[model samples]
Target: MEALLKAVVAGAALHSPLATLVQNDGTEVVLEPPANKGWVLYTVQSGDTLIGIAGRYRVDPKAIMYSSGLEGIKLKPGQQLRIPLTAGRSDREPRVPPGVEPYTVRSRDTLKGIAARFGVSELELITANPWIPSLDRLTEGAVLHIPTGQKGLLVRLSKGQTLLDLSGRFGVSLLKLAKVNGIDNPAEVAEGDLILIPGILARTTYDNLLAKREAERQARLEAERKAREEAARLAEQRRREEAARREAEAKRQARLAAQRQAQAQTQARRQAAQPATVRRSNFVSEGGYTYPVKSYVITTYFGRRGAYQRYHTGVDFAAPHGTPIYAARSGQVQVAGWSTWGYGYHVVIDHGGGVDTLYGHMSRFVVSAGEWVERGQLIGYVGSTGWSTGPHLHFEVRVGGSPRNPLAYLP
Candidate 1:
């Protein structure tokens, strides 16, 4: 375990910037300088090895080893290793700073192809164009501003609908295409989708670029305003519908409450009219007669003691005029007529048992003397007439021709 740990530590130390380490057995390990020195930087490309890279940059393998601190000629994708320039070549070409221009996409382009064409690495292209999600899914005919001094070819996919066909035409992997567009499935893309192509190109000098950007901003604002108005209109319509529904429900409830109140009032009147157990005997009598009107309180009795020395033969019932009167029993009207003396309008009913009932001082009589009337039939209306004081019904019960006490037969 100790030996393994020591080997790992020694391997890490070789990559650090320090003097070379030599063992007692004469095993030599070379140390490199820091990569921050002023040297030309090159990014690794696809199919790039240390030998090919060293050959392309015109540097010795041992010199690269001394500068990069690599134990062997191994190169990985996107690795940034410095290229030591010849002393006189320093003033040959100026290096461009990062983020200088936009990129333009072209037909049948790939990151590897673009990097190879522009003498730059795929990693440098990716870094320069951060707006692009991935380099592998660049769309054809889409323009990107290329940084001025960067070296790389911008590869773009075709603008047509067939992504699979476009990928085939461009010689780019389908997986890379999906990665660039953030599409989990490559089959989901249709035609005419815009994709970013990674490349370095000469910057354009178009003067209307700022105006075009402003126009796009204005268009976006107008769209948002229209959307908000439409949403508000729909919300107002919904509120009006809700209010109408509530009003209809309230009206229905009010109608139901009115019906329920009417029913309760009817029930109370019925219950009040029922005879209590204690008052039942008071309403009954041994005689067969019932009162002509309900609650027929006597205002005047049969006999009268007055200054004129007269006698009153009938009982006067204090009641509202036009109150319904029933036949004393099943009977026929004997004499129904109007008179000016004592009775103004009167109705006489004769029962078969030689008993007769007289209703006098009536406003009108509904039955004539020849009319065959039944018990409880309304025969006349009460009134104050023919020497009467106020509205009252004059009632008289006679047996065989003589007036009798009405209370003797009333129930």
Candidate 2:
């Protein structure tokens, strides 16, 4: 019965599709009794790396890694690992064996056409290389492997590098490298090309190129760091300059505001101490008035104005400092001095038939009280004083002690 069972197992193994991959001749193996099928644990010896152990037992290093649960921990002298009894190493990733040719895709090459040209079955070529991302699209300049071929080291050519340069550097024959990579002309090799080289020197060249790439990456990282620091420094400098400019502007504004407050206070005091100017009569007159200042822009109209919404009883003209102000109509000068009612250095004229005209915020008044001034005569100069913002004239036309729109009467 035992002999019959052994013969039956051997017959089943021979019929397996993978039987062709294994040789019939091999040494016999012994293991724990067939009833006990499980992993065996073994202590890690000194200088025993995971890969070395895996190769000795024909097991995959990655499989041992999973069984041992050593995801991040380092192996040491006393670490134990689980070794599987079954053949797990047979699942090793397939590699393109030596002597397999590599083909660079041409513009009009198809997978079926290339297989026929190389006299290899499409399945054989595709099975040998699992790295092909797509079988349908054969992009130009892309490197592919053919089943029946001669082997070499694969290297991607950098800019300005030629196959002749590789032949000289690796000491291999130029014709041999070209034949392995399916290149008709050795001189036609371009930059950014993936090609194969023919000797032991090919491995050395690949290693050197890898080291150079690492060095270049380090240099780029350092340059980027410096650029970021420079940008931050410049940004900080601009922020400081802008802050300083804003501070200076604020200080200037504060000084101007303080000056206005002081002037308002002085006028309020003088106004309180003096008696109010009484109207000459209650008679209301309709008299035509002239422009107070030539070449002036009407800044403030007679109405409610400004943030405080004060009732502006007069019209304001914007002009340069010391611009002459003229009398609106012929009348007796009612008052020509600092006003008791916030009008600094002002002039009031009583045009009979009960109409009166007043000019406020003057630098100086040329006419005195009771002086007869003609219409269009220069009575004063424009000034920024007593409730004034800048160099401008404040003109008013009063009828029976009430003010009217100056624009309505001027023209």
Whose lDDT is greatest here? 2
Deviation (Å) of 246 in candidate 1: 88
lDDT of 1 by residue, 106-135 (tens): 568775687677665555555444445444
Candidate 2 lDDT, 1-411, residue by residue in tens = 454456445433322212222224553433222322245576987656676566445567787888788784356998988866463222222222355655667678887798899886555555444344454556664556765654344555666788888888777788877776767877666654556555343333334444655777788899999999999999999999999999999999898778766765564455335543222122223654677787666666787643324588998776788988888888999999897787788999999988899999899989999899888888999997787767778899899999988777775
What TM-score would every model get versus the actual structure? Answer: 0.30, 0.31
lDDT of each: 0.61, 0.68
Cα-lDDT of candidate 1 = 0.61
Best by TM-score: 2
Candidate 2's TM-score: 0.31
266 Cα displacement, candidate 1 (Å): 41
Candidate 1: C-alpha RMSD after superposition: 22.5
Error of 1 at 35 (Å): 99
Q: Which parts of model 1 have CA positions greater than 4 angstroms off?
A: 1-284
